[model samples]
Target: MGVHHHKIGGGKLLIAIVLNLILTVVQIVGGIISGSLALLSDALHNFSDVSALTISHVAHTLSSKKATVKETFGYKRAEIIAALFNASVLIAIGIYLIYESFVRFYDPQPVVSVWVVGLGMLGVIVNGGSIWLLEAEAKGNMNIRAAYLHLLGDTLTSVAVVAGGAAMYFWHIYWIDPLISIAIALYLIYASLSLVKESTGVLMEFVPEDLDVEEIAEAVAREPDIKNIHHLHIWRINDREVFLQAHLDFEQNLSLQEVTRRIEKIEKMLKHRFGISHAVLQPEFMRDDEKDLIKGES
Candidate 1:
């Protein structure tokens, strides 16, 4: 199932790259001819999108490699690494756009034909198409979703640039050029910050948002033979793979095999109910409760 989902994600990323490359060329030429810094900045932003999509494609391919003896987890972390790289690129682009917008605000430049502005409107349409193509897969994967949001922001910025161009053409209000650029920069900041937060959370191996640790402890404690549960740990190896480890104290006089059966049941229950597939339960006799299964803890 993981491999199937990744293949779909890779296909979507390839489509996005092709569309974005086409749009970037169009925007660059249109921006240069029109002397619109807003259009030019957006073109550069799309160029960054191209890089981001490429990274996502490579990461998806690497993530599907079978596990080797040296690396038991295989290459799943490649996707997470790619997600972090994408977020970093977003931050860089956002900062550069913000700086350029400030520079243009102080020295606003003349914008040319409304025809060039019309070209930018076409860019908005293309970006919208790219967003729709990736939106379905983004729901299940963060890396692709970040790329989608970036394109979405660029699409909106293209609309703003077109509106600003139309205003300037009809009214000779050159200041709208810098104003539109500022709006695009702000949008980039908003979207990039969200991407950074999500990527960081995943890299930190935080518990999956839907699984509450306290609730899990309570559930395990409810087992008929369980005396207590402690030293519980739950975290994700990636978005889809969750790992849990804990010490299970069994009631006195339970056979070893019986205790093993109970632990196996708990593992199955966790997988079925909470999406946790890799769980390690260490059973301890009630008399040995004072001794710690995990060393180096007080």
Candidate 2:
């Protein structure tokens, strides 16, 4: 099967980017006119969404290109790279927002609540639509997940702005508007940093958190024709592919056909049981080599 099976393409992402661009501009104007920090922060989040979605769209398109000798993995990793960049950008923006919130608190101002509520409502609608478009693809792909989380978080932030603006309009609680912006910043920091760690793990070729090496060794050792499995390495090439390679010491000298058959059987078992998408085995009769489960990173 293809790497991008069931994944969305660039066209939907383009639409999302366009929607966010428009929302960002409108919210910025409204924020400036109303002197509302909440509106300005919402506009900032929308702008980040536009940047993230644009990166996601480019990566999504590149990932579909056919692999070649110069790029054997094709562009499958483009999504992971995009995700890392977007997440880092988000964290920086979050920190900046926090600093701005402090400044706003230090110098309080009267905000026009009507514009805050109105632009906030617009934020909800635009981000909601973007979320709808990208929701399905986010589960399996980290790149899209980063962008989706931006939309998801911003949608909630917009809701908070509307609530805070309502308080300011009716109860003279203008101080709460900066607090709303702070809340948005805190959430952005939390979500984006987590994604940054995940993307880093994938890029470092760390063993997937879900799979254990000893369990795999035990399963392979259980094979009647196999003596032991050693020097095992398991890592994900991207979000969707997990690759494993090991040296399998056989019980005795066996025919080439028999060895191939046993290898195929082990491959199938790994796929069915562990969701390992790719497996490579080196058959050995009595070769003197490392017997440890993990020698070092390959």
Candidate 3:
């Protein structure tokens, strides 16, 4: 299911990648000729969009590959890795923009407002279209969301450039260039932080933020003939797929057939209640073991 979904995302990413690659070159040249720091900052941000989209495209492609014995989970996590990489780049670029803005604040340079306004208008159109293209898929997929954010940030920066250009043209307020750059940097940092936190949490094997182990155990305990559930662990394979493992103690020394039927019911309960995609439960009857829900020295 994930592979098919990624295949659809691939087409949108390809279009965005090509568009951003072209826009990056145009913005860089335009920024240089216009002497607009804000325009240069937008160009740098656009370049990151190109790189991020490319990474996402590759990840989507890799995710479509079948699982092998060597890599049992397949490449579903490729998109998660791409999301991490994109968010990290966003932070680095944001820091760089802020530093550049401080330098510009000290010694503001005069810009050609005509060139700045004209190129910034073109940027708005290009980035806006890219945002529209990716908006539908961005809702559910973190990789797409990061790429969408790159385009959204670029759109906002382009708007800022247009405003700054007007300000410079009317009042000769050169410092507005740095001010707009600073605003763009702050926004990028704010937007990228959650993606960075989520991706890092997944990489570190932390339990998914929305899930509660105790709540899950309590829910499962409601089933018939269940003595207790313990030694339970849950984690996500990606944004959509969650895997669980646990020990299930039974009240009766049931037959193998009865145990299988009971286990099937519990699996269904987990799937319906918790959205767990895979479950590996160890069934036990009248066996002595550590009964803690979380079985480890705390």
Question: Which has the greatest lDDT?
Answer: 3
lDDT of each: 0.81, 0.90, 0.90
List model 3 lDDT by residue over 63-108, tens digit each: 7788999998889899899999999899899999999999999999
What TM-score does structure 2 among the candidates reach?
Answer: 0.96
Largest TM-score belongs to which candidate? 3
- Give per-residue CA lDDT, model 1, range 1-298, as digits (tens): 8779778888888998998999899889988888888888778878888988898889888888999999898988787777778777777777887787788888877789585578778878888888888888777777777788778888988888888888988898888887777777777777778667766777787677788887888788888888888777777766668899988887776887888889889999899888887999988775454434233457
Q: Worst ten-residue run, lDDT, model 1?
A: 287-296
lDDT of 2 by residue, 97-156 (tens): 889888888787899999999989989999999899988888888989989988998999
Model 1 regions more than 4 Å off: 287-298
Work out the TM-score per prediction: 0.91, 0.96, 0.97
Q: Residue 86 deviation, candidate 2, in Å?
A: 1.1
